[model samples]
Target: MAKQSTKNKLDTSALRPLLRYAKPHMWLFILSMVFAVITVATTLYAPILVGNAVDLIIAKGLVDFDGIINIIIKLSVTVTVTGIAQWLMSLCTNKITYCVVRDIRNDAFAKLQKLPLSYIDSHPHGDIISRIISDLEQVSDGLLMGFSQLFTGVCTIFGTLGFMLSINVKITLIVVILTPLSLFVARFIAKNTFKLFHQQSVARGDMTSLVEEMTGNQKVVTAFGYQEEAEEQFEEVNLKLQKVGLNATFFSSLTNPCTRFVNNLVYMAVGIVGALSVIKGVGFTVGNLSCFLTYANQYTKPFNEISGVITELQSAFASAKRVFEVIDETEEIPDSSNATVLTSVDGTLDVDNVSFSYVPDVKLIENFNLHVKSGQRTAIVGPTGCGKTTMINLLMRFYDTDSGEIRISGEPIKDCTRDSMRSMYGMVLQETWLKTGTIRENLCYGKPDASEEEMIAAAKSAHCHGFIKRLPKGYDTVISDSYSTISAGQKQLLCIARVMLSLPPMLILDEATSSIDTRTEILVQRAFEKMMQGRTSFIIAHRLSTIKNADTIIVMDSGHIVEQGSHDELMAKNGFYADLYNSQFAVT
Candidate 1:
């Protein structure tokens, strides 16, 4: 089947990358293998000692008691040493497995930092998280099983076979011939199960994404009475996951029982053939036949173990492929080696002949141009679907333009290192992000070294100081994005305070005060006036009342700037800007 072929190809491809992670701990791997050899050799030798004790009993009265006593002592010592070797092998394998998993997790997280924001925006946060957490955990389980069982199982198989061959060639031949049947059964089931397990893993990721989406936006779902719809969506994904999971489980479970049946047949044949050889009075004595039968059982035991491991390995390979996908994505374009780092930025911005789109053939911003002198306040106003946020993204170089040049203080941004260029501006967006930390930590995020006096001043200016003092621990109270105690307005004010603390040369405020009450908005707007006095500022406002004092207001429609002027001039023109401004303030 096409699925089986795909499974094989992916297994081979995924293995190389995994081995590269394991190669760093090759010494541990080699030590585990050495212990496995010692464990298997002693275990096989114990059965031969038992056979020798049986042969020592010639008759009840004439038995060699000393010989039997010596064999018992040897057997006891052999079993104890085997247990110690097995314990050491397990310890080494465990170390190697966790070490490799830790390395993989570290690499995956580092790769995410280098990935383009576009890649993150396009994928589900929960799915990416699943690959790094749940999927990697699956890989860890698989690796542990592999190292613990695979090496020991392999050594046991060959060790048992050699012992059997030395005892009697014909009986050994019977086992070798029948052995392929077990392999065939195991391979046939494993081939079909790999694709099913892969599907199950993907389905689980989808379910995780849906759960994250609903939980993160529970307020929206509750406000709109969308609980029923959300439940229906969750049930649909849950059913699909259950179906694929059951199919994969059913197929993999068949591998063990089916192989055991074939192995049981091999055991029965060896028993009958060896019993006949003993009755024929051949050179093969009772002890030799018993030893050969013991070897036959031990030989076939690994087939059962390895088949189970193959089932587990298939799932591991599938999960590993998902983790690798994130690590292998093309990262953001690196800054040129010779890129200059801007210092003492003057805040002059020039955007000339710029064009861009998130998707090809659906242009968003085209041939846009603008120039802002240092210390001037420019306002950009547009309808909801217009490219207001896209313009901000371009200025920050979150996504590169298709064709254009944006220069800051006469230096093209593309030629400036992203860190230096972004450092020149303080930004506050409509969406607020607060990490899980104390209020003081969040306030001082942009300026870690800001003094307590400076942080208090910024918070007071943003009008969030009164609320911060009311919390249980004042500034020391810990909070996160899901901290239910904080209102949306307070979160926005905290973000504004964060930007004020940094005091960068330029500012980008995109609907920055949308959540604040009208009374607080007036106070914050006055504070913003003082902050923007000499800093070049870009303000994107839906409320026309907020940007009335802007020296230049650029009105955009469908990516092109239709009008650019002072507020009074745009009002006099009675054109698109006038219509947009009036539409917001006119009495209903």
Candidate 2:
């Protein structure tokens, strides 16, 4: 993992991640654009028909009622058909937008799975969740409403301008003058809004983190009587979010009204100019003047639409930038490009001069060396934070050693595929994490293809069958939400059963009996001893008495192995192991 100071900042320029989703729907986009152009052309033609109808009635005084009726019928059909076409275009736009958003969300989540644990530790869970949910939703809104409309509106503006110039070049020039001024105002508002929108997204992430923290730790707050403190902290985050939101809203608010004002000014100028041109006998007929006015009104529609879409575009761009930042993060502990799968294993393990640290410039394990013969039982004991758990992590290949190598069966773990390597070992942690399922399902977690008899036998070996059999539904009882119905010790036993079912050649027990009472711990220890027979095992324990009978007991301190031997040899030396034993279990 990179150092905190060097962690990549959110790069707004890394928005190409969205293209992976957009590419698949290019054909849909093309179809929608075709329909949109057709709709815009039909809409622009309607104004000309209306203007000609007025000229026939008022200027030439040639009513021709039947001809006027026929023109009206054709205009109605065109309007209806074009309206249906626009609706079809909207449906296509929505389909493409939804598929793109779905792909992005899926890719981002898959990337998270491959990310190192260190990244997760540094970043907030709620903040990550917010990006996946709220940020992606913002991107979807932009693609569906903003991008689609901007495409159609731009086409409409140019097409309308072309028709207006064809009807009367003088009026077209007057309308075209407002376009640059409107664009200038839009650019100015967009610059400020983008900055404010970025700030708002950050503030919102902070708020989400605060809320998640408070909710998850509510029990701690009540127990420690820190309700007021939690509330004050929440209020501070809320205030910051409010300030950022107000700033974003304030800038985005200016875009519409300013553009509309410019448009209204242009409309007034066109009216005045048209009246003068008529009185001066400049060959401006009633039809030409009416069409020019209609075209003038049509020109402002795109400007207004663009101004509105600018705000959404800024937000969408910000969301795209955030989502891409996550996708672009380098996987700190990536699998080796040439790594091969480990299909067979005998479980002999070796750690040779291994060194590691979670943070740079701080060593947690220094020149750590250990060797476990296949099918031997070994226990690691040390003071808190003496790198006992770190040793297990290195053995499991969760984090690569900063120096030296770790090997299984004489093969360096780094060269082995992660899945095939992990499949060879069964790990039981201090806390048992059970999904919402029946007892049978939890038991089969490790070896999903285990037969019923195999599951029952494993359960018996782990000392879990007795309790499970007492339940009304036995193995069929459904467990809900973290398996709250089971006792902590029962959950631990079930996890042990899960490991037993897998029957891997290697096993790791990291404080696996910490949650059970002393009597239950002794029972579990007996089951563990039986299970460890004929399998290489590494056990990390806080309770020294539980591991007293191990074949080898290694004592660690300050990232080095201070002492190692059988129980009697270590006690006879009266060194760090002796001191820890006397202090913890000596009994004054």
Candidate 3:
């Protein structure tokens, strides 16, 4: 049984990755700070002006209309100017945030390119995509909008407190008495909100993976009449996601209302206290009381803003933790630090005493040895689960051998850079994956620098040119959906064409023609003959006739090579290869 993963926890260390992205926007952040200062200063001045107006009316026993108009005009102008400044600052902040997000996406993609095949095998594609899309968006929201509001709120809160105390310390003290209680509630909501958001992200990834699987295997689902089963599975995941999402929403939604309620209670307390002070002849005027009340009301604005920001902060931090998990993962098969470029290679290959296992206790290959001279063709014939594909995987450095070494051109593959090692071989797997794009684009993927003429020649060599030419746009024809326009044979041929375009010195064919019809197989086999000439090749074939002309053949059983030699020699021995050949050809 698989070990259960540990519960998701907030990783404060994840914040360090954000600093690299923020460095470029330091100047803009500083400007936003300046704008925040101006905004806060303008906001705090309003209560003081009202207080002064009240004093003037009480002292003179008459309303000074001119004085009041002047104060109103000055306050309005200050507010307008400060609002413009804040807008300018917000524009710059948003630009920086989006740019950082774009960089993060690019970085993730680049890192994926460098990762070994084993990493991809261990992780699902949809989960990786969720980190790049949904997770990054959450982080961006926090950095762009949440950070600005948080900073402004903190500044406003402290700034308002300072001015309030200056006017009347007694009233200020009463209003702020319940702040700690509000903060405690905010903290509780934030903690639970983070947990819920993390669960939501995981559930979303699971749903994405299920949807991708169902879409990609719709034919199998329909053929097996398993639509109800699939729908049930999907609903199970979707309902789980809904539960987590609702919990996250509920926790986040509680922040504002709870903060507002506490703030109102504090305001009422302040009113009661101020009225008692006036009744007791504490020299509190009506204007003084009114100004203090206004300031008290202003005090809750920052708390509300902060509560909202806390919810966003929790989500952002959760997303950042996920992204950092990817970034922090040590690549299991990284290139050597001092590895050199292999500009050209001759395809001499050797595998000495190789052993491997995906799991710790089960061995896939043990004491395996193989050799192919430059320009030689070798075939590995095996029953299912006999480790033939694993041999190919080791040769391509998809997974490093657990013991012993693999060498190409007499150099250990581990010593060479992965880029250079991969550059020397052309591979075609059992399942052909074609991207949604033009024929030319897919063909050129293996050799981006290949000219248009070279692409056409490769297509012809793969025997796909005739079908491609029949399409509406020939090489430029677009394949929107993988299933609608292309048959399995066509996709396999396209894979062949793509490999041919690469023109590598070594080739590995892993049931490359398995999905094609017999006629198309003959065409593909002929093309393979042309492409494999004078190149080291490894053929893992299911059809016995396909490898009849191979220079050498090896039969494998239970992860061990059991028979070796030419096809006739193996037949003469009447051993495992002979049995396999007889069993396969008996019906034919």
lDDT of 1: 0.92
- List clashing residue pairs in candidate 1: none
Which has the better TM-score: candidate 1, or candidate 3?
1
Off by over 4 Å in 1: 1-4, 58-65
Q: Cα RMSDs of all predictions?
A: 1.6, 3.8, 3.3
TM for every model, in the order presented, reads 0.97, 0.92, 0.93
List where candidate 3 sits over 4 angstroms from the true fold. Answer: 1-11, 50-62, 276-283, 480-484
* Candidate No. with top lDDT: 1
Model 3: lDDT of residue 146? 70
- Among all windows of 10 consecutive residues in model 2, the one with the lowest summed lDDT is 3-12
Error of 1 at 276 (Å): 1.7
Q: Please identify which of the two predictions, 1 or 2, would achieve the higher lDDT against the true structure.
A: 1
State which candidate has the highest TM-score. Answer: 1
By summed lDDT, the worst window of 10 consecutive residues in model 3 runs over 1-10
- What tens digits encode model 1's per-residue C-alpha lDDT throughout 1-588? 786677789999778899999999999999999999999999999889988988888776978989999999999999999999999999999999999999999999999999999999999998999899988998999999999999999999888888888888898999999988898899889877878888988998998899999999999999999999999999999999999999999999999899999998998999999989989978777888778788888898888888888889889899999999999999999999999998878889999999999999898999999999999999999887689899999999999999989999999999999998999999999999998999999999989999999999999999999999999999998999876499999999999999999999999999999999999999999999999999999999999989999989999989999999999999999999999988877898
- lDDT scores of the candidates, listed in order: 0.92, 0.84, 0.83
